[model samples]
Target: MKNNRLYAQFSTGYRAPQTTELFRLQAGQTIAELDAENINSIELGLRGQVESLFYDVTLFSMHKDNFIFQDTNRQNISNGETSHRGIELAINYQWQYFYVAANGTFAKHRYDTNLTLSRINIQDNEIDTAPEHIGSVQLGLRSDLGEFVELEWVHQGNCYINPENSSEYSGHNLLNLRTGIRLSERLDIGIRVSNLTDEDYAERDDFGFGSYRYFVGEPRTVYATVQYQY
Candidate 1:
């Protein structure tokens, strides 16, 4: 047997348009009822070491759909769902006083609005933060000086940002760095720096004729951490 509940909410200052599919001054009201039961997740992968290097790889896929959204202005109530199919890779290597690790993700996301939504190809962006390409790499070493540390890095560029490729937004290559020392095998400390060059970027772009000014992610940040694991 299955049971379900339904609810509707209007914001303190939100009102939906009267009888509309989309494209109104006021967002539309949504009536939603769902049925769910017995859901679970599973992963499959392999791990092994070759010579002096270690490798782990995973291929996985998941899908979701059946959702709805209504804007306060009622002109942008759009609903859609998409899926992600991709692989995760990891590799580690060690050489006298030097260590390196690398990882990456290759995935594809596709979304279609339930009501043929459109605005610079936003109907396709509904998948939410699903980048077509993603990757990262890291390197570290205990310098011969025992104090001077050099960091190196590289990663794949994000391929998708906001449904369409050319919609006032572009993908970017992110960089990171970190270095520190080990007070002891039981306790170690380090710092990580991101966006080394301080590039101006946005994960989401707003284009509504200056109704409001939006903010994106951070420009740069440095953090230090000390930890002990049993």
Candidate 2:
């Protein structure tokens, strides 16, 4: 227990209706007449160090009332209840000239009560656009001369695209590389390459108006930067 710490937290949140949520017209309705959202959350965490390796892990749960969401008709409405629960982890290790760091999250966002979104019954359905798994890991090498190189991999899990849970977006994984070195105390140069594999994927996906839409992700690209500090 000497090298570890445990902690817990409780929090509450409130959010008033946004301008669009309050005034946006839907079908024959003129005003939203929406109520504010209330949220309650609890979290527990543990962090510690084992020699040169460090780790932190956390678990969290949250409940919301009057949760607002846009329905199939593009009208904002409030639901009776929603719940979110998740776990997060982060770890890092460094030895001499090499180091590795990683972090990840797994969560579920769901409707807690039966609700109707434009004639569709949604109960215990995952929230649209809310991915259940997301994570990134990085490996790097560095020297005393300020030279370093890092490679990272990022991942996203699939999720529903509609409140009805009838459609989903199959997630994506990406690779990125970065390298840099100090030319002098005040001068530095670096280069970065994103989407290294040029994998075809969508950064975002949605379903609306009886159609599926995608925002395409960028292709493999390289860029450089030079920095001078006064």
**TM-score top scorer:** 2
Encode model 1's per-residue lDDT on 94-164: one tens digit a residue. Answer: 88888788888877666644334334455545343455566767777776645335465544445433334
lDDT (tens digit, per residue) of candidate 2 on 142-210 = 999889999999999999988788888889999999999899999999999999999888888877677
Relative to the unseen true structure, what is the C-alpha lDDT of residue 228 in candidate 2, on a scale of 0 to 100? 97
Q: What is the TM-score of each candidate against the true structure?
A: 0.60, 0.94
**In candidate 1, residue 216 scores what lDDT?**
68
Scored by Cα lDDT, where does model 1 land?
Answer: 0.54
The top-ranked prediction according to lDDT is 2
Model 1 TM-score, 2 decimals:
0.60
